[model samples]
Target: MYGLVDREALLAKVRAQMHDKRYRHTLGVAESARRLAERFGADPDKAELAGYLHDYCKCWPVEKMRDILVRHDMPRELLEGEKELWHAFAGAIVIQTELGVSDPEILQAVRYHTTGRPGMSLLEKVVCVADYIEPNRDFPGVEMIRALAEQDLDEALACALGGTIQHLIEKRKTVYPLTLLAYNDLVSRRDAQGGV
Candidate 1:
């Protein structure tokens, strides 16, 4: 199992690698993750760690990311999409191999932070929702989503997934199948009163 990284070192590395805007986003994600952790009864330290490193590969050159994906034998389906969305998976690998983040929960949080999966763990939901509704995020209706997160996590996730699906459709972008499945799963779970 991988051990936790030194907090200061990890933050410094993230700051040095990310652009100023991205650095701010990381800070926002960290704070949001911490809050969500507290609300959901998750480990704030792990949430913060996962949030800090979730985008570690965001700024990597496309070629480098592709190379890493190739080395890892990542599914061609996963590699077929836009480069913008590849960072989540790529970042997970980097966090595991480069940053020594071995915790499965933390790694999974980073992995699915972009394209959510069905039956998400609490930590995963926390990181995913936090990334979307962080203070630095200024998308339309973000405040409302943030409020929803505080009230009902499943509702917030449904909203976030719906918003993402709408955005993708409006942009004429390919919607990853996993995201749709995740959205449906969340809606179904909520309707069935299957609490997370």
Candidate 2:
């Protein structure tokens, strides 16, 4: 079923949704997602597609994203929390309704790419991590996350989530609950592994 998606058509649609910089970032994320998926034993194709679709609504007007969230009856927490998190959830619905994407895994990946949830799938982890470590991304700890990604996906993602939480704290911005849950889940899993 995944094989049937028109790659060029989808790419064109994704490209149309953002400015040149974001489109370039999307491309980088797609390639990076494919690489991460291969390294982590996930479906490379699904990872790439999710990467392309992940930010489909990122540059849209806040009002537009809010409208979609309201129509979809998204969680009140999400609706009230950071607007930065809206794009992922709204993109999931937009891709399905407008772009004909029906794969649950891919949709889930897009939905959680920004604010990762507890018990994320490998594909979701791939896209989320790819978004952070993509070539266009240049935050302070990105290189460390990229390095950790090469060795351990969970470690890399936990580090990335930690960085995000810290950044939000520094900015006095609200930290989304799911992101904290995701980070804690990774930490707990590592602890359960006897601190390995």
Q: What is the per-residue lDDT of model 1 for residues 61-152, given as tens digits with 9 covering 90 to 100?
A: 98999998889998787789767778899899988898777899999999999989899999999999999998889989898899999988
Model 1 clashing residue pairs (backbone): none
Query: Which parts of model 2 are misplaced by more than 4 Å?
Result: 1-5
Judging by TM-score against the true structure, name the best candidate: 2
Collision pairs in model 2 = none
Candidate 1 lDDT at 9 equals 70
Given candidate 2, what's the lDDT at residue 92?
Answer: 97
Model 1 worst lDDT window (10 residues) = 1-10
**Alpha carbon lDDT of each predicted model:** 0.88, 0.93
lDDT of 2: 0.93
- Superposed by TM-score, candidate 1 places the C-alpha of residue 77 at a distance from the truth, in angstroms, of 1.7
Q: Write the per-residue lDDT of candidate 2 for residues 13-98, one digit (tens) a residue.
A: 88889999999999999999999999999999899888888999999999999999999999999999999999999999999999
For candidate 1, give the lDDT of residue 35. Answer: 93
TM-scores of the candidates in the order shown: 0.94, 0.96
